[model samples]
Target: MSEGYQIRNQSAPHFLTFTVVDWVDVFTRKSCRDIVIESLKFCQKNKGMEIYGYVIMSNHIHMIIQSNDGNLSNLIKDFKSFVAKQILEEIESGGESRADWMLKRFEFAAQSNSRNSKYQFWRYGNHPEEVSSEKFLWTKLNYIHMNPVRAGIVNKASDYLYSSAANYVGGEGLIEFELPSNPIIDVLRKERFNFEIDEW
Candidate 1:
C-alpha cells in the first residue's frame, strides 16, 4: 500500500471513505447492502472498533471510526475482506442473477491493479483522514448524512434507511452505533445539538 493510503496514528479516531472498485453502484442492490451490514455487525461483536457514524451510499461508505485497541487498520481490512467474500459467494451461487454482470465489471477494474487477485470488491485506498479538529468531524458528519440526499435517494437524510442519521435524531431502532466522545459535546451539551428527526 502507498503511504498516502496507510492508516496513520491508529490510536486516534479517523474519518474514512472507502469506494467500490470502478465506483460501481453495488449498494443499490439489497443483497450487497446486507453483506455490508452483516460485516459491520460482525466487527462490532468481535473487533475493538467503535463506529461513531456511518452512511452506506450506492458506491461508497463514509465512516467515523476509532479502535480502542489501536488496530483500526486491521478492523477495516477484516470488514472489507469479510464483506467481499460473502458477496462473492452470493454471486457465485447465482443468488443475484445480475451479479454475474457486476462481477465481470469488477474483474475489469482489478486488471489495472497488479496487487489484486481475481476480484476486487473495494478499491485498495481507504483514504483515511484523521479527525483532529472538531470542525473537521462535523464536516465529515454532514458530508456523510447528505450523501443520500445528493443522490436524490431521499428528501431528508434521516429518511435514509442505511445511515446513522436516524440514531443521531433520537430514533428508537436502527443499526447499533457507538457515539464517540467529542470535546464540543462537553462545551455545548447534548441539548444544544438538539438532534431531532424533523430537523432534516
Candidate 2:
C-alpha cells in the first residue's frame, strides 16, 4: 500500500475500494452480496459510519464514506473483519457452488497475511483517497455509479440494484446513505463566508 492511500483525516470523507483476494468474483451470488449489505448497515447503525455513496461490483466495492466518530480506520477494520468471516462461513456452508475452489484461494491468500487464521477474503489496503474538493468528490461518486455501466452489467447506473445510483435518481437504494452536498459551499457557509480548497 502506498503512503498516499492511507487514511489520514479520520473524520473526513474518503473514496474507498474493497477488493476480493485474487479479484475473485465472490459477489456474483446474491447471498454473498447481501452479507456485505447487511454488514454495512450494521456499521452505519452502530459504528458511526456515514456512507455518502457506494456500489457493489462482482469482485469489489466502491464507497464514499466517513466516520462520524473520527475513527475511520478502526471502523473499516471492523467492517472488513466481520464481513470476511460471515462470507467465508456462507461459502463453507455450501451456499456457493464453487465453494471448494473459492475456499482454496482464500486459504492461500491467508498464508501471506499474519492477520488471518484460516482464510483471507478482502485484500489488504482500502486505497482510501480523501475527498479533498468538490470536484474530486463528485468525480469519485460518478465513477462508482458508472462501474456497472462500464462493465455492461446494467445499461443505466440507476438500474443496478446494489448501487446508490438509484437513490441519487430519487429511487430507494437497498441501504441508507446521506446525499452529499457540495463541499465547497458547505465549507464556505460553515466558515462564515471564507473557504480554502485544501480545508475540505
Candidate 3:
C-alpha cells in the first residue's frame, strides 16, 4: 500500500479507484460491467453504501463513496469479493471470449497473495482519497465524469452511459446516486479563478 492511499476516515466520503488485476480490460464486456453495477446496487440496498458519483471504464472504476454504517472498509471488501466471484464465474462458464487468457492472469495474480486461492480479479488497495472539502469533491466529480472524454470514449462526458455524468445534468443514470448540492457547485463556479475543463 502507498503512504497516502489508505482509507483514513471511514465515515467520510472518499474518492476511490478499483483496477482490474494486471489492468486487464475485463469491463469491456457488458456482462462484466453489469456485474459491477449489480454489486454496487446490492451494497446500496443492503450494506449502507452511499454513492455520490461513479464511472466504470474498460478496466477500472472510480467513485465517490461513503458508508452509512461507517464501515467503508468492510463494505468495500465485501463488494470486491462479491463482484470478483461473479465475474470469475462468468469467465468459468465461458461467457468471456478471452476467458482462458484472463483467468490465467487472475490465477497468476492470486499466487502472490494467500488470501485468494483460485483468482484475484481486482487489484488490492482502493487508493482512497478522503473528500475533505467541497472543492475537492467537485474536483473528483469532474475527474470521474471527464474520464471517458479523456479516453476518447465519448465526445462529451454526459454522453457516457456507464457514468453518473447524465445524472448531474438532469438525465437519468444507470444507477441511482446522491447528488452534490447545487449551492456548493455554484459557489465553486464563482470562486474559480482559472478553472479549465481540459485540466480535469
Candidate 4:
C-alpha cells in the first residue's frame, strides 16, 4: 500500500473504498452481493473485523472498520482478496448472464498486473482514510449511509437493504456495530446523530 492510503494505525477506525476492476457492475447480481456480505460476516466473526458502518454499491463497497487483534490492515487485505476470489468463482459457475464480458474484463485487468495469474476482479488499493476525530468519523459514516440514497436506489438511507444505516435507527442488520459502552457513547454524544438510541 502507498503511504497516502496505508493503514498506519492498525487498531484505529478507518474509512475505506473498494472498487471493482473496470468499474464493472458485478454486484448488481444478488449472488455477487451475497458473496461480499457473507465474506464480511465471516471476517467479523473469525478475522477480527469490527465494522462500524458499510454500504455495498453496484461496483464498489464503502466501509468504516477496525480490527480486534490490531491487524486492521492485514484483515482488510484478506477480506478483499477472499471476496475477489469467491466472486470470480461465482461468475464462472454458469449463472451470471454477463459472465463472458466480465471474465474478459477481469482477464484483461489481470494481464496488466504482473502479480495476478488468472483474473483481477477487484481494483488495487483500498482508498483508506483513518478516522482520527469525531467529526471525521460521522462524516464518513454519513457519506456511507447516503451512498445508496444518492444513487436513487432508496428514498431514505435507513431503508437501504445493504447498508449499516438500518442499525443506527433500531432495525435488525445482518451484522452489528459494537458501541455498547460509555466511552463510545460519549463520543457519539459529542455530535449527536439525527437518530436517537433508545437504550444502548
Candidate 5:
C-alpha cells in the first residue's frame, strides 16, 4: 500500500476496493459475502453512504460510493471494522473449516501492522479513486460490474447476485443507489440499462 491516496471529496462518488488480507478466498463462503452485503445495506440506510455500484468477489469487494453526509472515510472505517469483527466472530465460532488456518494468517497480518490489535481481516487502504468525469465514472462502473465475468464466475455481469449490476438492470441489489445526473451514467440508467444490459 502506498501513501497519500486519500478520499479527497467525501461528497463525491469514488471507486473503492477492499481486499482480504493476503488475498485470502474468505468470500468463497456465502456467509462471509453476506456479512459484506449486510454491512453495505447498513451503511446505505444509516451512515449516509450512497452505493452507486458494488461487487463482492472471492478476495475483494469493489464499490462506487459516496457519503451523503460527507464523511466517507469515517463511514468506510466503520463498515470495515464492523464487518471484520463479525467475520472474525463467525470464524471463531467454529463452523468454518479453515478457521484455524485463516485466523493464523489474519493474526500474522495483524502482528505486522501497528494499527490492528487482534486480527486484520481486510487489507488497509480501500484504494479510493475519485470519480472526476462521466466517462471515467462509467468506465469504472463497467469494470466493477464486469469483474465476476472476467474472473469466469459468471457469463454476464448482471447475473451476479452480489453486484449493483442487478440495480442497473432494474432488479434490486443489496443496496439502493442514488440516481446520479449530468454523467454518462444518467444515459446509462435511461437508455443502456432498463433490463437490457450493454456489453462493456
Candidate 6:
C-alpha cells in the first residue's frame, strides 16, 4: 500500500491521526491509555509541541498539533516510541494479566511484520490531514468530539472521558485546550460550516 499523505509545513500546525497495528484496541486498558497521556505530557514539556485538541480512541488517536521547533515528525516519532515501550513494559510486567489472551493476539499480529522489534504497538502510517482551511479544521474537531457518540459509547460527546470533548463543553479535562486562531475560525465560518454540531 502507498504511504499516507504528509503535510510538512514547519511553520504551520496540522491535524494527524495514528492507528494501532492491525487496528488493535490497545486503549481499552487504562495502562495503555496512560502511556499515551504520559507521552503527550512529555511532548508538551520537552518537544515544543502545542497540542490544540486530541481524542484517544480504542485503537487510534487524533490530534490537532503543531511544533514550533521544526521537528514535528521527530516529536511524534519519539512520542509513539516512548508510549510503545511503556505499554510493552507494562505488558511484560504482568500488569494486564487478564489480557494474556490479547497479548498473545498482539504477538501473533506482530509476527506478520518483520520490521517491529518485538510487539508492534502502533502502525507506521500517521495519516496526516493538514488543516489549512477553517472548514476542515472545524470538521475535524467535530469529528474528534463525536467519535465516542458515533461508536455508541456515549449519548453525548462530552460524556466521553478520554477526549477533549469535555474541554470544549466547559468541563474540566486532562489537557488545556485553546480555541483555534480567529483567522481559521473566520475561514470556517465563511465556508458556512457549523462549528456547533448537535447530532451525528
Best by TM-score: 3
TM-score, structure 1 vs. true: 0.86
In model 3, the runs with Cα more than 4 Å from the true position are 184-200
Q: Write down the TM-score of every candidate.
A: 0.86, 0.89, 0.92, 0.88, 0.89, 0.84
Tens-digit per-residue lDDT, 93-162, candidate 1: 8777677788998788879989788988888778898888886787687678878888898987888888
The CA lDDT of each predicted structure is 0.78, 0.85, 0.87, 0.83, 0.84, 0.75
Highest lDDT against the true fold, candidate: 3
List of clashing residue pairs for candidate 5? none
The TM-score-based order of candidates, best leading, equals 3, 5, 2, 4, 1, 6
After superposing candidate 2, which stretches have Cα over 4 Å from the reference?
183-200
Q: Residue-pair clashes per candidate, as listed? A: 0, 0, 0, 0, 0, 0
lDDT of 6 by residue, 46-96 (tens): 888887778899989998888879877777788888888888788778777
Runs of candidate 4 exceeding 4 Å displacement: 180-200
For residues 1-200, what per-residue lDDT tens digits would candidate 5 score against the true structure?
A: 35767887878889999999999898998999999998888887889888778899999999888898998888888999999999999899987999999999999999997988989898888889999888778778878988998899888788898888877766566667664554456566546554235542
Where in model 1 is the C-alpha error above 4 Å?
1-5, 181-197
TM-score of candidate 6 relative to the true fold: 0.84
lDDT of model 6, residue 176: 65
Which candidate would rank higher by TM-score, 4 or 6?
4
**Lowest summed-lDDT stretch of 10 residues in model 4?**
191-200
lDDT of 2 at 33: 90
**RMSD in Å for model 3:** 2.6
**Model 5 CA lDDT for position 167:** 79
Scored by lDDT, model 2 comes in at 0.85
